[model samples]
Target: MFFHPMDFLILIAFGISLWAQFRVKGTFNKWVEVPTRTGASGAEVARALLDRNGLSHIPIEVVRGTLSDHYDPIHGVVRLSEAVYYGRSISSISVAAHEIGHAIQHKEGYKALTLRHRMFPAVNIASGIAPFLLIGGFLFQALSLIGLGIIFFSVAVAFQLVTLPVEFNASSRARNLMIAEGFLYNDEENGVKKVLGAAALTYVAAALISLLELLKYVMIFMQGDDD
Candidate 1:
């Protein structure tokens, strides 16, 4: 039995994405609990940054889940995972500061972040339709449906592209704030860097996976149209 090239590509992409996620998670776990010399909990580190930035009113709450930490711009809340909220490691501090960086972006009206937020609705709509379009196109041999899938996936790709800057900037801000605010000493800074760098890999993996999936659909549609 012969397998389609597009199917093979998707399999490879999914495998790579899973591997990347595992690697990032391993890196995070290995570093997340190693206590920082300063003995500051993730919550303390987060509060310091927010206070320094005059965002003291913004609430930091622990939300249950692994790697669930994020800033909710609409509600002015920073949600940290239990591991991060209670951990007193350089990794925890770095992750906390990173979420706070997003809060800062919200406060300052960062253009890319703003644009990404605005595009969320369209991106969500596109994502909801993508799988149906792809499957329907294949089942019915409809090039138009596949083309629509490609278009929707393109919107998702754009959202991912916009996300790159927002994430990278947050990491950058996190590192700088950690140093400038004395959250991590010089030697401890490396640990923070490693943790944040590992986290960034997951995002990179996601974008790459999305791109590969988009390519797979394009190839399928091209083959169908040629038939």
Candidate 2:
């Protein structure tokens, strides 16, 4: 369990994840200095987008973190980071629109997002329990326990896979909506794409890493069975 041939590939994916993280932060910070031509704050832009989509009932809240913004479907609120909530920069507008995109997805019943939401509870439990099961199975050389752990870990991997489409769809919706609503100028589209694209890379890298890890576990389980 300490290492395997597959560890090299997982390490490569991990490096990509780190690089994606670096790019997202760099892109966000760079765009944050470029003010939107409309001078609209992030919250204001989010409110307008929500209202335009006939989602006026949704409220926006300021949260305390950098790049920690998210839409809470249960409580039905959009939470924006402090920088994204009040800033008038391109980053602020891009992030705000992207989250509003998720709200719109919820309203429209986007299949991928809905599936992701449905998988959340089980994935949460499976992820929490999988590590212990796998560790114990390996220590005891129990193929059955390892198989069970693999099943649970696969659930988590599936969740990560499902998340990719949800994030990409949100970014797509945001770009189109941003253009149609005149939230960004024509030339400013590049900045929006850059910011959103960089952010999307993080999700892709995460999914890739999870997939590779899942494969590694499956291989190990198969080897144990053969032995």
* Candidate 2: regions farther than 4 A off: none
State the local distance difference test value for candidate 1.
Answer: 0.87
Tell me the deviation in Å of residue 2 in model 1.
11
Candidates in order have lDDT scores of 0.87, 0.94
What does candidate 2's lDDT look like per residue over 1-227, in tens digits? 55989999999999999999999999999999999999999999999999999999999999998999999999999999999999999999999999999999999999999999999999999999999989998899888888999899999999998888999999999999988988889988999999999999999999999899889989998988788
The weakest ten consecutive residues by lDDT in model 1 span: 1-10
What is residue 57's positional error in candidate 2, in angstroms? 0.4
TM-score per prediction, in order, is 0.93, 0.98
Give the CA lDDT, 0 to 100, for residue 79 in model 2.
Answer: 99
Top candidate when judged by lDDT against the true structure: 2
- Write candidate 1's Cα lDDT for 49-114 as tens digits: 999998999999999988899999888899999888999977788889999999999999999999
